[model samples]
Target: MSTTAPIRLGTRRSALAQAQSGHVAEALSAIAGRPVELVPIVSEGDTNRASLSEIGGTGIFANLLREALVAGKCDILVHSLKDLPTAMPPELVIAATPARVDARDVVITRDGTPLHELRTGSAIGTGAPRRIAQVRRRAPHAKVVDIRGNVDSRLARVESGDLDAVILAAAGLSRLGSESTLHREELGLAEWPTAPGQGALAVETTVDAPAELLAALAELEDEDTRLAITVERAILAGLDVGCQAPMAAHAVVSGDSVRVRAVVYEPNGEGRIGLDVTESLNRGYIRRNGSGNEANAADGADPMRTARDIGDSAAHRLLEQGAADFLPRE
Candidate 1:
């Protein structure tokens, strides 16, 4: 839509970032009938070797890209949805949410050891409190060490004998095309639901973008995937938590309802509060995108309202179960 220049898509410079941006660029080119330029920006997260949360959590990765957007250095931004904050500036908006990839987490271990099969007291490297808590609960004997690095770097720790295993998001490994080559054990979604919005991509654009460009990009939005993520994020928002929170959520749509399973964990993995709730999507304006059926249309419940309702219900339910007791003490 910009007659003066090609649309620029900004992203981080790491291999996974490049891979993700390249993918979005290709899809945008195909859908918009115009090629999009990829602008690789180096984020503080890429340069800082310290703990991600210490430096400022995953938002460090989004800061530079967002700055580029506000400064008019790029026309759009593609971020891992899980890394994005729960709230955003009104001037910037997520314009498109393409179909999400697998959202489960996986364990990468030496000699192809599954999680439960790991030797007692074995060292496992990971920094995510959510993962640490779940690892502690599921494999209490294994030593969970705080780790910081990219997918390959973390996996290298296991390969080099620094740790017996490491836990990582399956989405990253798959995006980098290393899943097939690694010894992986996918954690159960029911037990380890993964971070909210994990495996999903968010395409952000300025509020002032051309209406035509916005509409074209919106075509990439998959309503079902977006709805599922909405449930997850909405729950997080209701809890007033961010990406660094020790929480996990997963949603699945069936018939005219969305079932959201979520958890809140204590910092030390000593306890947890969890809930699984299903809400009907038939209150007003039946959803025509996902699992569309004449039956769904017959009810007339609002899908958006239902999504928020399910998320709010889950949050309140967890709170009633003493979710606050599980929060990592400041």
Candidate 2:
């Protein structure tokens, strides 16, 4: 591939998706010294008005974009990491994961009322099972409305008096610059761990992408962000649950250590199970070599392997606690 050739980036047509893709395109263009073009692709999730679970879970959002990539309609695809299924197609690879932003959900209300303070029967809008379960546990009296739309339309419902409040990912609002005007209260991660890979973006390309493109993507990757989401997604995979399941997993990497917290809730939110675990990383064995390539584990103690082990351990503990009983039957 020529260094000056334009890179076609495929993305969903939603405002939030476009904004996120635009950011990635600009960054890649700078790094690769080439033009990056946005190729908006409509997805099944956008066309279907049904709830995410009713249709096919959040994975519907990625199917068309992945197809466009596979068919050579685009050189790369940008996806909201949380929307992707844990089991990826064999032909594609997540080439880069940039730095993550806020991984918390926020409550947007017309009157700036806190989520728990909403009046009895007040309507709260959200389609995510995780958010629905959290809202029910926190404000049992409030009516949970399943909503499907772009961020602007969802917020419009609250402003138009159709809904008292709506829950959304803080990252989406931040990306779209929609948070400044809204009266939002960010939910704390400790009390409300968000879905795995929330607030992160995935840059994916076919496994056979040009070596130059792969090298540019490697320059775009952030080591810490990749490692953290790796643990979260690994936990999700180990649990054997789909995106629609009412499960939340969050992992944070600190100096030489990572902490992972996960929870599973019943659909009605009456019951739940959670676990918090932290493990130390052997930094001495997992430091980057002098060649500036990938980190070399001197003793063969890979950081990514450690992250997966942490997630797998947490999933096993949750299973021991009967966390699967809280989830919907397959």
lDDT of 2 by residue, 115-217 (tens): 9999999999999888899999999999999999999999999988999999999999999987545588989999999999999999999999999999998
Best by lDDT: 2
97: Cα error in model 1, Å: 0.8
Candidate 1 residue-wise lDDT, 193-261, digit = tens:
898899999999999988877987898898887888888988887787667778899998766778889
Q: What are the Cα lDDT values of the candidates? A: 0.83, 0.90
lDDT of 2: 0.90
Model 1: how far residue 142 lies from native, Å: 1.0
Deviation from truth (RMSD, Å), model 1:
3.8
User: Model 1 reaches what TM-score against the true structure?
Assistant: 0.91
Q: After superposition, how far is residue 236 of candidate 1 from its true place, in Å?
A: 0.8
Q: Would you list the clashing residue pairs of candidate 1?
A: 282-301, 283-300, 283-301, 283-302, 284-300, 284-301, 284-302
TM-score per candidate, in order? 0.91, 0.95
Q: What are the candidates' C-alpha RMSDs?
A: 3.8, 3.0
The positional error of residue 293 in candidate 1, measured at the CA in angstroms, is 18
